[model samples]
Target: MSKAEIQTTGFFTEREFTCWRERDYKNFYPCQVSKQEGNYVSLSLGDMSYRFDDTIAEDIARCILDADLVTAGKLYGYIPKPAMRESAFDSWYKMNSSGVWNYFGEGEFSYYRSGGVIIFMERVTDEDDTAEIMGIYTIDDVGIKLVLESSSYSFSKLDAVWLSNALMEALGEEPLDFLKTSTM
Candidate 1:
């Protein structure tokens, strides 16, 4: 067995390079962002040598465009923030470690379609060792649930995997796996 080397090259700023390195899991993930002819940007993720398909690359580009549009308040319904997990965990931690002693425990989350409504289901354990299931209703029925696996504050690999899968399923396509392994 051998360890993979990590390196980056391109017209990337320090902040952009840092963000890309943080998102790299195996210590070697290449992130390329190029400006296209129009109001579009081209992005790629993986080892520098890996050749991504044009269609998949286009999908990535489109996802970026849609996200920019959504963030600019031009799109409606569920326009998920790129750092949703981070945001979620931040709120979770804040609620857990406030002026009082409340721990955000863990449980399961499931989502599906029913009656033309998009619903979010969550089960979380509180400080008192009690589990509660909560439901979230959204304007658009995306038919996906964002589940919080554990509330122990120490996030696990399984939690990360599940969240990744859930979010990809919701996004209709596998997004560029760009996230750092950090709480909040």
Candidate 2:
């Protein structure tokens, strides 16, 4: 069985949105990388989705800064509301909170979703990228799950495609067909 690792303790990827509700603050919802062009990006977070397109800015999309997350040019998809799931730790808010409210450090949380997602993207061997270990998870006060391929995840076909693309994004290179999955 594979083991899961804790990449963070809180929701690091979630940004404060004007359309967010109270309950939608905690926990991380799985997201699919629907699209990722030069200056355009899109993600499907089940109940809701996010898209960024800086037509005026070229390669600056990847140069996403903290301030850009909230003030950047964004487009809310799927119902214009955040998915329902209260977060135990709102790292985004906490990290940005006043010195008194900055309870958690930035690395303590993840920004990938599910509080923040921990993506296992290690090359199996140092020789090449042919064999690799890959997994996605969330770790918070709930405890940590650290292992490789220890759990089974059911993914949709579209999800598989997008996740593969996401893995590539994680690697900062070409996407790979690493995640073998089944349709939901």
Candidate 3:
């Protein structure tokens, strides 16, 4: 039997959205392009779902940032080679979060803190390309920040595609081509 080296505590992945239904002010949704409405972003995970106007770029950023880790871990778990998980860990840890900007439309950023998990999403109001992502470390109030560990642009891009598709699949829906654009 394979043992999970990663300890289980209050930490959760985006896939664990089902278990968070009872929690107040907590979100477990995934990001996706919406088909029911034009220029909208649909975030769906398990049975819980949220739809937002494309104009709310900050919300979209939160969804994307929040789901990145879970998606990366899932991808690493699927590789066929030995020690692949470790490789994924190293690659993920090597990513730099310096340029990351979580612009929340000129001081409109928000965070969700619950069950030892913290997600920070900020977006610059004028800049369309920059967003900041900050997440709490999975220990007992050590106050460690999760650094971006995406080794390369390709890695980040791959993870984004996986996230978009995973969210769509989890919703029992087909993936759409273009996600709604936002400027928040």
Candidate 4:
């Protein structure tokens, strides 16, 4: 067994140990890694001890580090309310108050709100009529603003993805495969 030490920063300083196996399993197991203080590393399928070479260990460590950074940055993968515009709030409020604007254009549409973030999804009547995420908006003291627009990469899609997952979890529905209609 090979072992390596990993150092991480932010919030606090910590040391992590990675015990590696000589053989490669072709896939990283225990798919989900834990963040329980000292238990920061994930193990492969065959061992109780987290085993991986420095390369794999570093990869896992990077993921853990990134997650920590996201948390530190207060970016838990969703639009923050302070980032929303008044127009978006009005639109959302109108839809919710009357419950009559659920359908728009050629397909059905719905919106989900959590914290300060709002996600809009639509099922277009075009060729690929699947329900696709349209945009992610945020509301704050400054009003509402579009945080993630489906057609461009100017914004982080991770927040939108997080919102979508949250929606699915709340509705007890299967994961939805949102179509990317952006021609760009």
* Local accuracy of candidate 4 as per-residue lDDT tens digits, 36-68: 233122322222223222232332222222222
In order of listing, the candidates' clash counts read: 1, 19, 14, 12
Q: Name the lDDT of candidate 1.
A: 0.27
RMSD of each: 16.9, 19.8, 16.3, 20.4
Measured by TM-score, how close is model 1 to the native structure? Answer: 0.21
Best by TM-score: 3
- Superior by lDDT: candidate 1 or candidate 2: 2
Cα lDDT of model 2 by residue, 1-184, tens digit: 1111112321112222111122244433354443232443443444444332322111111111211222211212111122333322122323223222111101111122233332322223344333323222212211111112223232223333344445335334454434433333
Which residue segments of model 2 deviate by more than 4 Å? 1-32, 36-38, 52-137, 140-164, 167-173
Worst 10 residues of 2 by lDDT: 101-110
Instruction: Provide the lDDT at 101 for model 1.
Output: 19
Query: Which digits, one per residue and each the tens of the lDDT, describe model 3 over residues 24-113?
Result: 554333423232324434443333334333334233333343334333343454212212221101122221254222211112323343
TM-score, candidate number 4: 0.19
User: Which 10 successive residues of model 1 have the least lDDT summed?
Assistant: 135-144
Q: How high is the lDDT of residue 5 in model 4?
A: 28
How high is the CA lDDT of each candidate model?
0.27, 0.27, 0.31, 0.26
